[model samples]
Target: MSENDTPTTVSESSETKDRPVLKLNCFLPYQLSHLAETVSRSFSKIYAEKYGIGIPEWRVIATLGEYEVVTARDVSSSTSMHKTKVSRAVAALEKRGFVARDKNPDDMREQTLRLTETGIAVYEDIIPKALAYSEGLQAALTPGQQELLNEIFNRLHQAARERDIE
Candidate 1:
């Protein structure tokens, strides 16, 4: 084609016409992420407002409360949170007197974390409220639906793990 003669190719309008439009509302990953965020934010309000702890801090507290003594690496692995996030949360909790750390007898570099008395009290106070919130959410579904949901979630979890292996 000569420089003077402009060439006509597939226009932007025609190219866009062939592309599939994504509906985020119906997209599985997007829907799952949105639902998880919504639930976490809603539940977090209970701890955030009452205890002044954010989600990461709450996760650390809950983990320590359950395990009694675990390292920061354990918390990160269990909660799937980054090591930096767990460390920061641990620092905040320690500052608030909610967590205590002790050097491991066998490993000087590793420290085990545990909940302080105050942390235990906060955990005790939040447990009932967390159960109530969970029950409230489950109440929206029938018993059969709840059972089916459990099964569906288990299957999805397994599928994700299997996919990871592949």
Candidate 2:
């Protein structure tokens, strides 16, 4: 038989073509997600180990530090966390002496959360370190790339919000 007429080689007992192929790694997105999770977890771990606060607790403290006083619902909205989660975190922070909850004088049923002096000191001590770590993370990317990433993430956030994922 001529070269073009020769029988094609195939997998033994199978009809599939015996050719090299490219296969996408479906775990690529998962791998990226895992990395992101690890980075955040590591940040939390460092903050907790050095400052004695959990991740959610740190967020609560940070927000309360900046706002001085805000409702638990507001913290939930700002953090994109659930109301129950914020409530629980606030309770934990209050138990730790890092947060103070006071019934709003104007509305007896409404309570505002604020960081205690100790919480402010802890937040102040960690903010610079957290920012430095953030800056280090972006050191490999150009300013343009960082901006583009932020835009893409914003769009994703909007889509999630529209879909009621929040």
Candidate 3:
């Protein structure tokens, strides 16, 4: 194909436009959630690349690490993931020898999840790396700025939960 016959990409058009064909600015309060999603995607990709586990699996393992044993519903609630997603993650982790499921004594129908010894070792290895990543992320921010940002995020999250669809 001739050079002039090739189609131009949207980003190239964006740069050459007189008034920015696309406004590209985020005006809604939920826009920050998009940024958070981007950050989570990047972190998950990096962590998965390093450790060979996906984000949902990581979330399940991490949550189980914090609490010795938790129900599938509890995992879903804590991660804000759907029940099916949590179930799939639990299944994957179980296959990888990281998690074990047992009958919940209190509720015979529900299952409780726990990390295996290998899973605990994996969590111990990843926690420091995760902390270092977070520290590196906040390295450029002043302590006050960090605190303010945390407060803002918490307030926004609370508001979103209050407005959530039933």
Candidate 4:
């Protein structure tokens, strides 16, 4: 029989017909990634326009703001950013006089990073704006929905951790 005239059989067509299709719009991972990118870009406009800092720089500044002192490795771990990205961000922050690095006396190769006074000032200025932005986003959801989303996120985090351990 010609290919086009061949009778369709379950075995012959099953590979293509039965295979589940992935819809990017409905995919959880894609949805999450798109949401994250959108939110990050929106928030980035705040600091980028006002303070001339990008997401990486903001992550470094925020991490240092909280930890007070840390290594580039620590910032990478905390921000889930690549070490190279963290290094570049640290260098940029230092150049901007928003971050200071001190060599570890015990380990000359290691450096502790901290926010400078100017960095602290920037952090202080940006925090309220961040909070307001976050609050505005949360305001779109009802309190119950917000609580449910928080719980869902916590569970997802735990599941991811477990999967990573495996």
TM-score of 4: 0.85
Q: For each predicted model, how many residue pairs clash, with residues at least 3 apart or on different chains?
A: 0, 0, 0, 0
Residue pairs with backbone overlap in model 4: none
- Tell me the TM-score of each prediction against the true structure: 0.85, 0.75, 0.80, 0.85
User: What are the Cα lDDT values of the candidates?
Assistant: 0.90, 0.79, 0.84, 0.90
Best by lDDT: 1
Q: Which pairs, if any, clash in model 3?
A: none
Show the lowest summed lDDT stretch of 10 residues, model 3: 21-30
Q: Model 1: per-residue lDDT, tens digit, 45-95?
A: 999998899999999998998899999999999998999999999999999
> Using alpha carbons, what is the TM-score of model 2?
0.75
RMSD of each: 9.3, 9.9, 6.2, 7.7
lDDT of 2 by residue, 1-166 (tens): 5423435445533543555443223344554566677778878865888766777788898788778989998899888778988888888888878899899887889998888888788788888888888898888799999999899889877876798842
* lDDT, model 1: 0.90
Give the higher-lDDT candidate: 1 or 2: 1
Q: Which scores better on lDDT, 2 or 4?
A: 4
lDDT of 3 at 110: 88
